[model samples]
Target: MMQAMTAAVAAMAFAISGQTAPGTTTRPVLSKAEAEPFTPETYLRYSGLYSAPVADPWRPKPIATGRPDYLVGGHGFASVQQAVNAAFRDGGAARRWIGVLPGTYTGTVFIPAGTPPLTIFGLGRPAEVRLEFTIDATVTPAVWAEQVNAAGRYAEGDPAWPMFRSCATKTSATAGLCATVVWAQSTDLQLKGLTITNTLLDTVDRGTHQALALRTDADRTQLENMRLISRQDTFLANADDVTRIARVSVRDTYLEGDTDFVFGRAAAVFTGTHFHLVSSRKAGGGVIFAPNTAPNYPYGFLVTHSRITADAAYQTAPTGYLGRAWDQGASATGYLPGSTPNGQLVIRDSLIGAGFNTVTPWASAATTARPFTARIDEGRDLNDVDHNRLWEHANRLTAAPAPAAGTTTSPGTRR
Candidate 1:
């Protein structure tokens, strides 16, 4: 078996239950009925290769709430995979609910297609419902293969290697080894009050360190009070290369990252959210959003009524930009597969902290000759109309830097 250090740490044990309002005088709640009244325990069965949870001293102990139709951390399912398997066993369209009890889940939780329309809600605050995973993109697949083969962690013909390879890109040498903490691919799904983090420890080499915190390709999806954290490519709201256009609405969420943190081709609406810049010292600053909206698409990223703030560390840099046009013809996949860069975004009625670059607000170039589209419509934005393809509508900057013609890497930088 591979050493514990090579693989993700183990975690388990939690239950889903409700709590009374603050300062409420209501009586104590009743103990949950572990077994459902009519549903067969067999009905909730699913098939998949099961990995035992490794022992991690820091991992939180599971909480056992006796709830039916719910998988508690410690008492019910040993892993979130099992719970998801059970939920999608029949692949029916009936509405179902999965309550995640307070505890940190450490592994990948995939919501596959054809699953029932489901709602996964955390029991407590976002912090309390934590789902964490780690995958360092700096490690090449050959290195991973050699290490895993030497460690003897996985047996021959195991699915781990193939799945790990699937995470990488066609051009990445470490292709098939990139890690995505959460992959949400089902439609009509809802996630509320959860913190999904990618704890890949490679802050030094930010180049190929593409640790994704969450990748959502679901349409008509809703995210409420979600805290998504990672270093690069933190949250991807995009569809598959062949799927239909993705539509998502994120409300009351918190997103933090460094390079192209919020980049995708989805028609996403972010409302009342907080975008934090957690760039490293060498990064100077980073771009927050990189949208690749097609010309025919009406909406791309509509960020309104949100706050963009920087940590004390990130404030040291000149400032970060709001977003850039993600249109790399050769590198672009997913929506608008090979189309020219036509990124559309609208930041309106938002409070941008002083940590942003007031001068060159958008990144002008990613490569030597490849510049972003210079004709981003101003629509009704109040800021100066000099910046290329990046328009703002009633946004406030803190540092208030002098205005400039174009930018090298001022507001947004290349990935």
Candidate 2:
């Protein structure tokens, strides 16, 4: 067994269930009913591997009520901000735990500066009722990006104080462009057991813009059993060498998106998770991951012991990927000689359902600069866009050989 120390003091468990799905190139659907009841051995039967630091504690906290400057329900306060604000309000330094209840509270959440390194543990079983947020990019992109950026140690020292406001990326305007959800800039923050979903994507509500779900811009942040689902450009692991999602562990979670959903310049391990591909009209299935790594950056995305699935109709078209490095020559930040250099994305030892498009994976304009055309046509010839670069990885951990080249999951073949 590998040390599995992909995370510090951490053990990653990657497990899949049932059998393959019909029409798609992925494993079977998990039995939600049987999975609800947890046992020591089969705690995460539905999703396979279980992430500890589990939400075993419970406190029925009040919601949409209560004033700050007072601890509510448990620990610091009722609102996440209130609790965070109270922690650094007096500039006193100490770690604390914020216990949040299970509820579908909807609104934009901003984690500002002075955020103490802490843990937001849910009060119930997994996925009970998640605290979901939806915010517009044009309205608060800068504020969104600044919150996490504040927690970083800038070479310039201290960095700018965080505010729930926008900044300039377009025009002469200094406001909203890189908005994100639940950005934890402070180190040692651990969030376990919640569904963080519906994040506004890379597209701005007004025009060209960027959106994201949770961004661990600080070091030593842990998200255990939390589902990060969104459209394009979902989770941006911005922690680099100096910082990292340092010891970041995403265990037994589900990450879904359409185009380049998981992109960033950070190194993190994604173990025992299901990465689903949303639909795109183009011939190739939607691009699952596009990792933009800084040259000499030590880490990148490591996806293992999970399954890859796409929407029903597109399985034959090739949905999944061992991602190609996104080194767009003109991309301002990732501008490397001719392309952006990226750390490896090893999708290893897991099942690939039919939902994954098996053919023409690396056949995109990002690499070829021309529209894709199927030259090989249903033949195992040289015309197929070579996958040797994508599949022939040195670090990809292996579990089992995929069923076969063209095995489709049906009720009979599905276990």
Candidate 3:
């Protein structure tokens, strides 16, 4: 099955590479009222698995009982960046642990590529230790640098200062890349029991602005018991390059956002997590996941044993979508399938709440606005790369029941 799917994807890529004209065939777009209601069993029977076995969960070893290598908050260090700088200066391939006490540290943290194996964890609950900022994608790099270095947090002698300068000198085309509150580029990085938030949720209108809470661009990154909050593009599981593999394992975490909250191109697995979709920007509802997986790379995202819920406002109306493909760098008219990045995602053994659209859960492509076309609907083999690469298997949904005060209620049964 896997070999056939790979051959099909490769064949599709080869076919589109030589094609000059758009395909003539068109699939019928079903309306919300006329579309058939979504059934888990029926959907799985048609849309076969587009997933593979993920790597085992990776986690950083717990800090020893003695004083940590570096400490943030209290009398240790003024900011998390300071501790990270100290770690870089005391450079070695050995693991370095930085324990953060209970306090909110507001700043943009940039962990450079050459840092040693590092783990920055909170001493208390995730809510007690916060690393937050409010910077949107529209901000220019120069303006972002000023805001980030306003308090003189990053001094000239600091090892992170040069890294910050490198990021600040990015072009306007990559303005959105600098809006991350915490960006880590070191391999074997781990974050635990902390809250990272981008407070740009209500500052700007609901548009294409992306404010990332945490962006990891390294391999073997693990996040445990963390809270990531934002609006669009909350937590990015990124890679240094498309060819290089970056695997992130997020376990027992709480992620909250409105649109495309969890997105990126890395091979990420989210297990035992809670994905909360807020209704603050309810104009067009919201999307939960957007994976921009490379054409050749099979693994994109896998969400297993997780709960995906939405605000109470969407319980009755059901306006949210499960996810959509982020066709990054695809042209408006010449969106050649198989050649371009086709996102692949699988949500198995999970509980999808009542707020998502029952009939058409997946939305159109994020960048090219390509209509959501599934290979199964076209009578082709499953995992055909010519269409949207989204699939689900053995998933369940919550029953439809009126929500109670400050809580969403479900019928005593699972669908």
Candidate 4:
């Protein structure tokens, strides 16, 4: 059995390395460029991803004020997964609230599709209710399944059992998808006042070890007053299908990491949030956002009225990069112009504190290493595939470094 699992993992890794493997579907590539020429009007159009009105008021209410259908910690369910399983058993279309009391809950939590809409919030402050685990991207799916199911939280008949099985059967190409502490695949899912951390910070080197705190692959996912702490690939706002639109909204949250921390293909909006770049990764600096928006998707990632700050170690020199285009699955030389996933991001009306390279904040593409080139000087379209699609408008830099608390000062003064 161990030998069979090892062979399966090896096959998956080989398949992920670009060879066509059985049961693996290749991402569709565009034969011709269909994207409209980007202009100020284009930016306005994409901004609708953030400006559009949402169905529900994406806010968190105190647990004391409302009655939660299920509870975790204290005299409640032994684990968050147990409470979620109970909610799944009492299946309904109506929203189910799960109030999590103060304490640290370890292990993976997978919220599968077809479950009732959920609002999982902490009773105390975000720090007081922590959900954390440590798993790097290099682990195979079989091994990951053993570790996650060691406590038997997900039984064979559990509602989330299939979800766990799906992740366990993933190949090396999708192994990173299994490293998340909280993987939410249900629409209208709300998480608030909690800290989801992946404690794989210093275990591995500052390489491609991706340990995600939270990964949302559903539409209308709302996160408020939450903290996602990790090192690489921390918070993934992803869509199950690249062709389908998935939207996520994060408000008043704190995300801390080093490289490509906030990344994915979802149309995600961050408002009044704080992004802290830890300097413990590499000597120079690290990247923050790595969006792999589809070729024709107008909306990618929008960060407005937020603060992107770095640690005090970067006070003397600027090294951090604002973002990079994640041309996923593209070879270093075989990247197609209109076919590959081009990341689109806009940082407007935000505070970009010190430690970022002012001259060239954006970096090269992740997979293809495509150089960052914007043609604003030549008045060319911003979304042109030839140039990187990262743009910033009305973003000011802070002359002062981050404070001792690791939060950036007010954006009142500009550099």
Candidate 5:
């Protein structure tokens, strides 16, 4: 059944890719009233097995000492990495709860795969516990070329060498550091009540700068009541590879970014979340999401019962786009097998602030065409009709009011 479905999806993707020609046959656009209603069940159904499966509550057995398996700061371990190392030494069957005291931590944290069931929770409020780093994607190609040649991470004539050179030639941030601040490659991981941030100031002038705070590539991962702070590529919902679909959920969390921040190809669901748009150098305006949903994956990214706001600095430029279809075949980054450029996003029952232009909130990152016009670039265009897989139902946004000066955010007009 799965193989048949995959074949059908591939056929649909091919059809959509060929539909961008002038005077060609295309799918008819659906009017607002004619569109299907966006609901939680719709998202879950598309998510398929990638959504969190029903499991019994996780209750780790207590040790005789009655203490946490590891503790960070507050006189325990001096660093988060230290605690993680201790957890590794004790093996997977030991105590599973790792407690973090209220404090600001500045460093990178890695949780490797096949570790064990773990729950890392913070004792204080979100503002109290912060794991942060500063690395911007501003290194020039010349500098990158010299540095990589000296380090010998890549050699000429290799299949991946050209891809590396291409990325180096582009203005790239520290892709390694930008993409791996808090990488969780292990399954059954849970992080709650803390803030993970990348304290790098990114602007369009910086050139392809991508500093990410957290990357969740594990299965059945859950994050609750946390704040993800960054300018670009803030929170990436990803998977280990293309064969298996990973599921991640962020509930009652805060995510802020400028461009393609909340992105990736994983089956991710954001419920009761707040999305903030910081001032970006992209004068065309920043995009909130760039979902590269695989053709076979029905659910890409779901933003439901959430609020999206923008700072006053975004008033002059065009309003932000709710999301842009990030088709994979448009660039070298999307050149992997089982990759499809078609994007699937659902925005439903959310209060959208005036920061988004109501008439055309959906856009395409692969092309320069306006919203609702499908124009794939570099002869890889797919389904240019904006409303094809991207749907909006019962979303309410008020008319734009005059911008106010200060740090205050204007409330959205909720009907």
Candidate 6:
């Protein structure tokens, strides 16, 4: 009996001290879920695995040049963009990774056609290396703004007679049309650990394309742990067509712009991200997720697990919306008058900070109880082809419960 009791106690001691469970031994098993402290590598690993899955069908291998010479001048490529071009153009190499060492390169990057999926991993997320540039529509390859035709299509023949000559380049409060870098057709372009910025924020003259640090016609891209800073139109997503679909995921990233800085018609998802609203301008143009869908697709925009801030400096009674359905040439397309009820926007499990216009909608007149033509069964909220429209407050925005408290975020929003 004594031997039996002694053996049982020994077994219990072994079970407790041998560390089958957590907190039992001096050195516990390091969970793959935990982040590494005080190390850039930890950020790299955390961002790599959790930020967002490569939205591409198949993630191409990382391109490694055997040596670091692909980096021009032994630091960054002759251009940050040239390195990107090399990675995607070369079909022979498997693991394609443009390892940008630490530095700031100034120039506009163009991701032309025939580029493949790319992953540009830097030393740390948006820290070790950076790309910054500025371009203006005033001095663009010659910009032209056209109106929609009778058939509700983009009319391309005429240009807006230059109203204001020479809109000087300066970071201002109003939104403009310039872009620092732009991409097209490319998918799964990963911007990891880099700071992309534009210094042109001054909107004194107005009616100019406020330069953007990053703009893309690219589809299905992911930005992780990157910082995007600009006053207006900081990030622009232009599409070749509204009907064709493009998906974007911005995870664990930071975006700070002055007025309506984030606007695009692309279907996008923002998760665990931060939005910075600046204070310089009285124009209350706020952040917006324009579901530029073709009034046909199901999902337009998805925002989950993110935070918004109207900069403390913005004291002039900021005048815009948390978001609004954009009117892309509504004055031209009678379609603009019919745009309100067609938007599909979802905001879940996210925190909406102030600088948001809570009283009135920032949506265009196209969204205010406009006439519906081919009206479907909308129950009662939409009844007439003339008077019924989408209710703006229909979705007041709410967050659903997560199972493990913080393991995963809500799904992407559809516009």
| TM-score of candidate 3 relative to the true fold | 0.81
Q: Each candidate's lDDT (Cα)?
A: 0.57, 0.46, 0.73, 0.74, 0.61, 0.46
Name the lDDT value of residue 192 in candidate 2: 67
Per-residue lDDT over 165-199 for candidate 3, one digit per residue giving the tens place of the 0 to 100 score: 77688876556767899989898898888899998
Of the candidates shown, which would achieve the greatest lDDT relative to the real structure?
4
lDDT (tens digit, per residue) of candidate 1 on 195-286: 89888734457565777888887665678777888877789887554224666777777888877789776767776677877655236557
Q: What TM-score does prediction 1 earn?
A: 0.68
Query: What is the per-residue lDDT of model 6 for residues 300-326, given as tens digits with 9 covering 90 to 100?
Result: 455555655455333235454555444
Give me the runs in candidate 2 sitting further than 4 Å from their true place.
1-78, 90-93, 112-114, 136-163, 166-177, 199-210, 240-247, 280-284, 316-322, 332-340, 363-415
Rank list by TM-score = 4, 3, 5, 1, 6, 2
Question: On residues 28-49, what C-alpha lDDT tens digit does candidate 4 reach at each position?
Answer: 1111122232222232233223
Candidate 6 regions with alpha-carbon error over 4 angstroms: 1-76, 92-95, 125-128, 140-178, 203-208, 281-283, 315-318, 336-343, 365-415
RMSD of each: 17.1, 13.1, 11.1, 13.2, 11.5, 16.8
Candidate 3, pairs of clashing residues = none
Writing each residue's lDDT as its tens digit, candidate 2 over 277-359 gives 65532334466776554433323566656655665445544445534455534344523332344333445445555455343
Which of the two candidates, 2 or 4, achieves a greater TM-score against the reference?
4
| TM-score of every candidate relative to the true structure | 0.68, 0.60, 0.81, 0.81, 0.70, 0.61
Q: Ten residues in a row with the worst lDDT in model 5?
A: 15-24
